[model samples]
Target: MSAFTESALLKKLSELNTSQQSIQTLSLWLIHHRKHHTIIVQTWQRELQNVAEPKKLTFMYLANDVIQNSKKKGPEYGKEFSNVLPKVFAHIGESCKSDKLLGSLGRILNIWQERGVYDAKTIADYRGRLHKESSSSAAGAAGAHPVAATGNGNGNGTTKTPSDKHSKVTDKSEKREKRKHEERLSKSKRSRTSHHATAATPIVEPAAPAAEPENGHTPPYLPLGEPPEPEELIKALNSIENSASSDALVRERIAKLPPEISEISCISKLEDKEKAKLLANQVNEAVDLLNDYNARLAAEMEQRTKLAAMLRDFQAEQKELLAQAEQRLDEHKKKLAKMLGLQKEIHDHLSNLPDLTQLPDVTGGLAPLPSAGDLFNTLH
Candidate 1:
């Protein structure tokens, strides 16, 4: 062991009333630290060769603890005293140094602070490089597209096909294509009318307005032209849904209009009292919708709860089954052990009997031993 490691071990031994096993373990650990320190010195001697001062101080601090703990027991612990003191002196001799060790520790601290030890300039540099590469990649991608030169379509950096480019080049070509497609579609549609048109009825356009009365007044009850096509109706609904502020402005304007003026407007023709009644009806409808939604949500939650409970019950049943299987396995093992013991006992009994063939030979051998010469020798 290095002097530093031996000293540390001695100090540790002094601190605690450790058992023999603990002492042995600590000795092994000390040897390991010495080996580690040797490796560290080999790699970092230039940087850390002068770190003896800090290491000495650290050792002293550890030693103090040991000495203090030793004082707690009476001085009659001679073996502990003998074992610790020589190691301590040896450690001090080997590791104690002044300027070199202190300077080394200061340099290490400065380097540690500057470098952040874990991740300082290295991380920042990596991040900067990554960002630069990403921006370059994005610019390259943007440059790859001819469409990027013009702000058409979705403005994504992608090239367009010649046909797609032609479509965008002039409205005349697009209109012509649309008209041709419509003509072809119309022909096919007329041919397959019975099959295709059966899914939905054909919409009938409203007739143009007839000449007004002699006073030039239009009828108040004219329909708004067949209530728009389904696609148009859907688009109108989407626009209304998307334009909440516009909807609110419209509603506000309707609400502020005079009764006669409101009555002239199609959407705001009702009196205040009638509007209030309509609003109350709407609120009631919303409440009913909310209640229905909540009821469905509650039913889903109850189903989830039931499923969780069933899962928990299944887990408990599985655990019980596993425990029963284990119990059965243990019982079988015990029975097998008992049967083995009985078999062993039976074998022992059978092996203890003498062979019948050996009995006569045994009797003859005993008779020859009773001869006169053998008897005289036996008497002596």
Candidate 2:
């Protein structure tokens, strides 16, 4: 088992086929990471919801494989799947009325019941939602994987159209001729005009995949946009010390300001003509300094708040990178282990074989059979 990401799981699900190898391999991975049963089931449900009707049965086949196989090892996957299966059944049962699908569903339900994959009540619920009466040989018919009805999943790895998934491959020229004929019928009653118009319209080729980023360029983050570094942020915060909040002398000046400058109740202190002018000058200067400082403080506050948001984004991007790296590391380790296992298997098999010297001496043994190449080595 390797690090399991939801995206990897979704990719695996999207590429899934009806082959026992495909289903069982994915099943084993899911069961190994059964602690993520919640996410696995949720991803499964989402995939089933998103696929075309024809391909939907493969998703169901996946669910059946995981549910039936995950039992005995741990019931977590089966239990988690149980929560969403009714909805899955309803979603699948409505769109898929294929007799093949119905028969498979019935057989699956029967297998589940016989194996006690789910409790009696749950079994009843599934039967009510998806079971269909079919021949008892469904298990035999389906062979190993329940989705054998799918023939070969998408046959040639192309996506299946909305029609039956098991349909035989149609000739491309036949389809093209039929489409052209339909176009002629739908046009102004002249066949030549329709033929000319259709001939003039070029077939649109499928678009090519986007080119990979050149010169080692890629997004700075797993998601778009990077945030300022801690060093840059610290510099920005230090620059904000020009603010009143960080200015001890400015705070002291504010504290020492006379009340007569701002208080109407203390206007009696400014009764003299010259003294009144002095008081007005004092008030004007204080107001100018305070107003300028207040504006700077507001701007600083806004900048600091934005910086906090950037910090949050920076942390999120870091976590995303770490998670991606961890997943890759686990996958690498798993591959390495598998390689070592294969190497050991090869060594063990070779050790079990008799070397050339260990053969029965061949002293009295019958002469070995000659090869066809040996006869040809001599003159004919």
Candidate 3:
């Protein structure tokens, strides 16, 4: 189990039969394997989503067991458990949150604190959400935790607590205040810079450029009206390629432009028209490259799919061959036993037969019952 890699564990889990026993086996395997907690949790969570109700329940129970077990390992293990809690909660979703679930989470957090690992932000967020849900669903507008406003030390509110609404409002106001503070700070800095610049030097202005198109859109790099020179097109491609904000899609569109430019630039005395044709050729080459990439990707995916199928088939064939071999060995043993018995019977019959010497010589010339060795030589 300690030697099991993430990929190996995932493959093992995928090959297992869908049964309660297998689920438990996987759970125990996970518990025993302490490394790759993140990978293990992700794989389990994904599989848990598509599983049946019984399996889902089993996984939930397994997660709880892991958490409980981690408690005994002390704080170091508890931190691992704490890291796993978020993924489990995400898998369970809002529907699975209960007092028991919260209590379990709370216990893990407490363990973490005891072990000297003390960040409970995730649990606190979950607890807040849980309280909100409980308050909304209950028959009375009762708060689950705080009923101090009702003048009772015990936490049982008959009416909706203003605290819940107040908290939401406070959060929004805090955000607004923070944003305003940042804006004020930025303005003050700008004002200070302007004051220093005004004292040091005079501000100069530059002429405005020509107006843009009526629609505020620029024409394409190679306009439809006329063919552009190869140099201009290559320059445009370089600008697009080197621009920081250019996305993958844009880069892909001009992928082959650079190489084409280099190749064309190396040739002497080429006409603009010829260069334009080469540019088109390069565009087609880029498209072909893209198609090839896609084809290779598809082929690799198909190979993987076929390999998995072949592996399963090979395992099945191996089992069948082993069973057949066992059966054949059993048949051989039975035949050997039967042959031994027949040989013993023949020996006994030969020994029981009366010696030919004791019989009044049936054939006068025949050697007396030819000793066993002489009979073998005569037969050969």
Candidate 4:
């Protein structure tokens, strides 16, 4: 691991901005030096505490990016950050008046829970600290509670002494007022529900925010293996010619090995020393050729083993992609079916309507109008 220095870390944190590029660049560096995760997290917490309030949210984004992207490599960063995140949340909550920033924190916390980044209890603890801090800040902003802060008749923060009879009357008045408030709320709720159920217009949903690239550039695809085509694999396989099995000429020569080299009796029967030496030399040459061919075969076998392993990995990733594709296909099919059903409903509703063109005209006297419920409530 490279040397870990607090100054160096502090420098990077100081240079950090709210941009995605800045956050991602820092996260990449942090993950690269993840061996020093404990120290990194400590330094991060210290910087967050000391940094100006406005930059605290930026620091939070950096932590989130690091913790999430580093999961596959190791869990050290996540664990260390989790230990400090409660304090980080509280600090941000105290200093941050922006509901948007606190909501982002809550969203990050939810993502952690969903992704199994932290256990339920740890997340709960973090959430509690966040809630407590947010609640205190909100209360402080809104000023103190009325009952405690308001004085009795005097400006001093003290309650006015009242007789028991007056106290009873005041309590009854408050209860009656509360009851009336509840009744109004109940009636409003019922009216809203009935209006919603009978509404004729289609409810339009809010437009979702446009998607942004991860690094403010091209979006990254998932790590699904993009294996080469079968033709490409075939060409590659054909290009590998390191072994005797790939050479027909070498195979033919091996098939025709002389008995002089193949048989022990043939070598022993040679009586002349020169002849024996010559035979030995010839055998040695043949042996060298075979050994060289065997070495080539060994190298070729190693290559083949590697190719096999690569193909296995590629296939596994392809299968995962295939499963995801199938799921998407199912969802799209369901959506298509729903759309078709909606079209049919529209046609049927139109057919049920009384055509104004075909209606009998009453020029001298007006005809009674059709009941509105009969037109709309037909779908019910």
How much does each candidate deviate from the true structure in C-alpha RMSD?
33.0, 27.2, 25.0, 28.6
lDDT of 1 by residue, 1-380 (tens): 22344445445534432222232333333323433433322322222223344444333222222222223233222234234434443333334333322222222222323334324553333223322333344456556655654655456655545434332333343244345444644654454444332433222221112112336543211111111224544554454443433445545644554443223353464557887686557556555655565455444443343333344434443454465578678988999999999999999998998877765566445544377988899899
Query: In candidate 4, what are the lDDT values of residues 248-276, reduced to their tens digit?
Result: 78777777878788788896689899998
Q: Which candidate ranks first by lDDT, i.e. highest?
A: 4
- Please report, as a residue range, the 10-residue window in candidate 3 with the lowest summed lDDT: 219-228
Better-scoring candidate (lDDT), 1 or 3: 3
At residue 247, candidate 1 shows an lDDT of 44
Instruction: Tell me how far candidate 3 lies from the true structure as C-alpha RMSD in angstroms.
Output: 25.0
Q: By the TM-score metric, which is better: model 1 or model 2?
A: 2
Superposing every Cα of model 2 onto the true structure, what RMSD results? 27.2
Q: In terms of TM-score, how similar is model 3 to the real structure? A: 0.26
Local distance difference test, each candidate: 0.39, 0.61, 0.49, 0.64
Q: Count clashing residue pairs in model 1.
A: 1
TM-score of each: 0.18, 0.35, 0.26, 0.39
CA shift at 2, candidate 3, in angstroms? 9.2
Pairs in clash, predicted candidate 1: 50-101
Ranking by TM-score: 4, 2, 3, 1
lDDT score, residue 156, model 2? 48
Residue-level lDDT for 121 in candidate 4: 92
Clash number for candidate 4: 0
What order do you get sorting by lDDT, best first? Answer: 4, 2, 3, 1
